[model samples]
Target: MLIYHPAFDANHCLYRIVSILHSANKTGVSWSLLRLLDFYYLFPAQLKEISPWPSQISKYKRLLKNIPQQYEDINNSPRVFYDLEKFQKTAVLELIAKGIVSKESFEADKLCLVDDALPPSFIAYMKSDEFFNKDEFKIITEALPMVGLNGPQGLKKRSGLMEYIYDA
Candidate 1:
């Protein structure tokens, strides 16, 4: 019984990771944060429910309102998150192998994009409307600021997707 799912698709995961690193800009994202952010990128509905909303919810009102109902809320997020861990790691490794991301940087715990490694066309596509869901990507961008404010532990707690208490 062959199975096909975006969550298990290497190319899909690779593209998503690239888009994430690109949107993340110069100060690359931490490995843990990348995992968390990728989760939301894959499941925007979960992002809407789990994100730490600002005091001024109006800031995200439009984006939140735009999320289509097709992405129904995920009930067992923790399990799904854990299940995708291996595939996520594989995608990161593929990035390093492809030289799009540096192994040294990833080893140092930050997934930094390699300068000029990606083709200009690819970069343009990432920024264009043709990329995955525009609203979803925007939501990921909007949620990035919280990475600094909450870090991995706080994000895990808020998402209820991991055991952060014992994480050092």
Candidate 2:
């Protein structure tokens, strides 16, 4: 069984945190992408700069606990491409502006892996509960079928998800 430790820069991480806030607020959000939503919905207000850690920690943490599926495939790129297209330019630009991330990697949803594990506690600090747990919005978790996944034995091969061993 493979355990996934979502990285700080991962779209899923932001989505998990933001969606929890949206759900708390009862906001009708059906989209899978969020960084764009963060810019459109939380930025300018500087919600991303939430001090002392984002206040939405508990909520985001709760939403993050929902991931248990291991099903994956090679075509997982579409979900990220279409869902995050709007934010691709903006988020990457912001990262570049902040010097937090490199620009070369932002052109595509080209996913990466975090070698070291990260706990969710630090994530709560990115924004305040106001944006993380907004009362009017709600969040839903989505997966990119093959995000950062390597074929069996790390070989350049694709295999059936049914063969995946849970708790491996």
Best candidate, TM-score-wise? Answer: 1
RMSD of each: 2.9, 16.5
Error of 1 at 124 (Å): 2.0
Query: Which 10-residue window of candidate 1 scores lowest in summed lDDT?
Result: 144-153
User: Per-residue lDDT of 101-120 in model 2, one digit per residue for the tens?
Assistant: 33343334432212222235
TM-scores for every candidate against the unseen true structure:
0.83, 0.25
Query: Clash number for every model?
Result: 0, 16
User: Distance (Å) between predicted and true CA of 16, model 2?
Assistant: 13
TM-score of candidate 2 to 2 decimals = 0.25
How much is 166 displaced in model 2, in angstroms? 37
